[model samples]
Target: MRKISYNQYQFKVLLYDVPKKIFILLFLFIFTLILLYINLEKSEQIAKKHERLKVSESTLFIDNILDMKKDDIPKNSIFFLDTTRMKSPNKVRDLTLRQACSIESAAVTNENVKVFIVLVSPYKTLDQVKYTPAMEAILSYKNVHVNSMNLLQFSADALYDNFVANGNLLKSRFVKQHTSDFVRMLILIKYGGTYIDTDMIVRKKLKDLPSNFICRDHGFLNAAIIRLQNNLGKKVGKLFIDDLIRNFNGSEWGWNGPLMLTRVLTDLCQTSNVNEMINCNGFHVLNEDICYPINGLEWNQLFNEQHASKVLQSVEHSYFVHFWNKLSQHEKIACNSSAAYAQLARKFCPKTFSLCHEYF
Candidate 1:
């Protein structure tokens, strides 16, 4: 007030600018922090989802679960199908009727062979009314089993029961339907038998099948269709099953253990200390079309060898077709009408042809 000057006016202006500058900088810092927080949350969620989808627990020796020593190698195998799996899922995705028929046809070809049909689910419907006629008319082979397992095991397992009983597991797990296969595979490794699935329809009878050639057509030795013939010790199979039981308690992939089994079987089928009868590097048949199933028409991959040449084809003259033809009621009826399918269809449902015409 005594000496108001130009310098004093300049100082006042500078003071005024400081608060405004501070406010702007503070606002920017807060906005940037908020953006960073959102990005971090989004990144964390993606990481968690990826972890859940694809993680292999097989190689990792889980604590307190059955542990296998390096010496516990070498084993034999068999082929069996657990048909009971078909009913477990709300949507029976991969194990279609056609797939089941193929397996039946394949197993039936060997009259003297012992085939185990593994099924895991509540013994709800025998499906005998639907499949019995088909089985009786076309297949008369013996040594074939209708191995059905109790669905209660999933619930009875103490840990898995709660989720499985509530249908929570059913919603997320597509391979629960194939639970029988896993069990059978373990049985084969432990007990020395074959494990196959119902989705498979055998075109070739494995009578006097070469002990250790990788299978063809159904690409990869689909555990769904296996040939475990080596006379390995009982402990071998137990080791495999233990893996299943442990994995089952830990995560969902036990319901769908492809990569895991692939690693295990490949190793077992390879350098193992099993009896000398065990073929070194046994066959791991990998036919890309193996995934095609019955309903599938055209195959995408070209083979250097056609099935006709390698004794590699399925359902030869002696056995029935696993007609993996997943068709609608209309399609099934139409299929039954064809002259070729007519004989096959009528053989089972004596009146199949008439039924097809009725639909018309």
Candidate 2:
């Protein structure tokens, strides 16, 4: 063999080491890839845990099941009024003493239940609307909640389309009362709670009442104090709403109000005899005594001074007294007097009774 130079020998040695160096680099690259994959997996697991924690934080665990607790839940009683429907801010027609009495009575009587007053715009909060002494008293209660809902702001979903169409179509001919009936139904269905008329004065804790129930007034099933559930009540509400839209007859006075509900009840029960309690799909059609202890004809006795004793005695066992404000709205409640309305207001709504002189 010929003698090799030192540079040549070094070149050969370098050539021999090329394969080992490439193997080492390949191993290092593979190891780095493995480490990256392991780190990515750990990060992914942490992200999943964070998402689960967020969900757990937002949802409420009731009876071992997750339930979304919205602002409308926990057995609330709702009242609707159009004080802010068509008026300037702060100059709107404030809730009348009678209305305030009704609200305050509910707030005081139902200490365990939440009372909500749903007003129409341009009122957004309790502060924005004109506050009467009675309203202030009711608002001061811890269980009372005030909300402002606009008819135009209502959702236009399938149920709402019929609702909106029926309301807007009847706007030119019908009064705000017609639209209020529709709103009450929609609210009860969507929120699964109670809807009480502004003329009603609650005399008992409504939380103990059945979840899905309606009352009858003067041989007719009424929606004055409607309490419904989320699941089945939603279906019933949708049915009534659709029926109103399908058979909207604005020409008649109570067509959309009582008559529509009567027709729906008739169809639901397959009988026209709603004079007594009728149970339909766990929904109770309660007797008038539960809400309307005094019928429409007897409604005048509530404000009659001589009938004060009789009215108080009559509503002793009643949960609420429907004053039939439509007819009695013109009647004035006397302060420091022995009238039935006066007596009831003083007992249940002392704030409104104290401020009665200003309104009278």
- Model 1, residue 10: displacement in angstroms? 99
Give per-model TM-scores: 0.45, 0.74
Using lDDT as the measure, which candidate wins? 2
Candidate 1 lDDT, tens digit per residue, 244-278?
A: 54455324443445444544555666632222213
Give model 2 RMSD, 1 decimal: 12.4
lDDT of 2: 0.69
Global lDDT of each candidate:
0.40, 0.69
lDDT of 2 at 349: 89
Off by over 4 Å in 2: 1-69, 83-93, 122-127, 157-159, 162-172, 358-360
Highest TM-score: give the candidate number. 2
